[model samples]
Target: MPDGNGTFVKDFFIVGFPGLHSTYYFLVSAVLCLVYIFILIANGMFLFMFATNKCLHKPMYFIYINLVLSDVLFSTSTLPKIIARYLFQDGTISFSACFFQMYLVHYFGAVSSYTLAIMAIDRYIAVCYPFGYHAIMSNRNTLILSIVIWVFSHPISIMMVVRAFPLPYCGTNTIIHCYCDHVSITRLACTDRAPYSFPAFVFAMVILLGSLAIIVFSYSFIIFAVLQISSTHGRLKTFSTCSSQLIIIALFFLPRCFNYLAANVGITFNANLQIVIILLYSLLPPMINPLLYSLKTEEVKKILISKLKKHQVHLTVLS
Candidate 1:
């Protein structure tokens, strides 16, 4: 293990976005910034609708609101920092700031994973034991679950943060990605230790793989239940509601799990693959969530369209 606690690694290098001419990179950045703006707006709307709408005050929507909140936080912690570094060309952060960024990134990432686990449990109760769904997944229980996620994530994230600070880094401090991720910094550590790497892998397993296993197990039962529905219409109706969530979860989980698992095993990850993986993880999940709800959900789509038309009407009236 490398050890450079007191001024061993002074500076780091960040190799911004891969394979774009300066002009092309600028154009891409403009588009990405616009996309991020929409992510904020759309996720905000989900949170607001869940809060304000009486009809949406249910366990399912409650978890959805948490999911949106987690997604927003995850993006907020990571993307803006990346954009500032790569797109804006201001790629410098102090040691403390870097650690803070890493901590928050892991914090929110853990939150999102735990939130997904709660959603999986919610789905299990709703689909598998429909009669007890209300009593089992009550608002109180959901709140408790959310609280547990935050509490559990904090200590685990803090462990990673604690281990990272002791490394004596006097060499390059440039991070290859936009954010101060653990992997990039770990590789740059002057004094590496099994503790840092192992804890990170442990957290990833607990949060990422643990949640994924729950999802798979719950959905397996769900699929069985769906198949048992006597009516084809009933089957389709049940499947339709869950399909979007399944897609969203898979998109969110697969690449992230792959990236981390590969990295943990000491694989030399391809930078180009990293960009694609990170982009999909960061952008696609948020981009698709609103689309899934608005497109596949009849009620949500109707409401969204109505809202759009109402805005148009207001403009027309003013004009």
Candidate 2:
């Protein structure tokens, strides 16, 4: 369906802080700018270290590389546009571009979820069946798993975006959220949005909850396995390996649970608080994950420190 001009709504205005005073726009934009910078620098360093350090050429590190890649891509998909909207006072996004962004936002998100589950599986094998971990999680198999996660996660997002694009959109074109998403776009349809919204919601649950179930299963076995260790120090060491991963998974999944439950179960809460939680959880994992791994994982941290020492020694020699 087309409007008077015989075309769908060509563009949409992204509304950030709908009733925010104009005075606070710059302050908001500046803070977001700092966050975007940190996300890039932090994730970028992990990617660099993974590629350059031969010590990181194992199945576990390979999975982490994909996670880093997803975080970088996911952050890039939405942050720049939001920042530009606040700073330049331009919120208009072409209709096609909005859909494109929406697709990416979910695509990378799904990939990250699946990859995290795969990582848990990796850890599960390493701990519970250490003798067979290598045979079970070969480097070639790890690479293939990463590739499969990226490729297979595309279709659901594709279906959601394609379903929404051709529907009649004659009324208000303002998307109330900071970014375009399946829900935001479908909610704008002039016709009843049930067909697209229902299928999309089902798929969203399958991906988010399905991946989460796998993680939960893996960790249950992990906990039981840890408890059976004969020595207290041995139990502590094994648990230490999973501490950062547990933190990362909790931050990733908990807010998502709150969000989906609020939508489906008809729970009442502040709309602003909902937005804050979504934004915080999405950005929080990426921001903190690099620091968590570098500090918590001894091998990577040692390699990083060693590289820094070498660089300093080289500088001193030059001086």
Candidate 3:
């Protein structure tokens, strides 16, 4: 359906996995629904703790709140439609709606990347410059940095959408991925997408590599500082503190770097395999972040344990 401007304004169908059979739609939807529920519950609990517990209001946790919000919002933007796509066999998304999702998907991704970088910086300061960490990563300064991250991520994502949205989409309206993104949607454009895609590819690489470089730089110093510890126990303890973050960094960045590079460098993957890779990198971090990053911390654990004991006491009285 073309509006008065003669541009085609039509809904696009999201083909989740080209190789997935309709018979397994219900099963897949159920599994995704469970994952979505878990993400909400886990992240939601951490958010609640952050809100109520003043002890968790350090610069590090302040930065983590952004990651939590980004994760939940990203999952919200993507999961429902795909869940419906599988559960009800309805994958149609209006043109405007699809582009909106594309913006959010990319925006949140960039936010998470930068947030991780910022977290690495926080750890670097804590480990390498413990005396000055408080002054440098103050509550106000951390808040400002988080604000910068949220605001700074917008332009490239908005430009990606702005550039790709106006292109003529005709004939084939099926998107071969779980969600609407610059690459998946722009590939549907009726004109030459090379010019548009090249810039987007560049932007994606810049975001990924730029943040990765920061993490690596920060951690290199952190590793050096940790190794300088006089005692083996001190070194082990310091390394333990950073191990969770290292795991998350690996999960979030490594796979995505591979996917992007693979797509551009003529490395081919089966459609289902590619989609699986995307979902793993995009979805897994948000789901596991609370457990690996926040809950594992001693402060958070002590808080959770004290609260649980209080709850148990209340239950006993009620009984």
Task: Say which candidate scores most in lDDT.
Answer: 3
Tens digits of per-residue lDDT, candidate 2, 10-115, equal: 7888886667788998998998889989999999998888888888889988998888889989989998898898899888899899999999989998998998
Writing each residue's lDDT as its tens digit, candidate 1 over 79-129 gives 666566557766667678778888988888888777777777787778789
Instruction: Score residue 26 of candidate 1 by CA lDDT.
Output: 65
The reply for model 2, stretches above 4 Å from the true place, is 1-8, 311-319
Best of the candidates, TM-score: 3
Q: Rank the candidates by TM-score, best first.
A: 3, 2, 1
Candidate lDDT (C-alpha), each = 0.76, 0.88, 0.92
TM-scores for candidates 1 onward, in order: 0.89, 0.94, 0.95
In candidate 3, which residue ranges exceed 4 Å CA deviation?
1-9
| Model 1: lDDT of residue 52 | 64
Ranking by lDDT: 3, 2, 1
Model 3 score (lDDT): 0.92
lDDT of 3 by residue, 80-196 (tens): 999999999999999999999999999999999999999999999999999999999999999999999999999989999999998998757889999999988988888899899
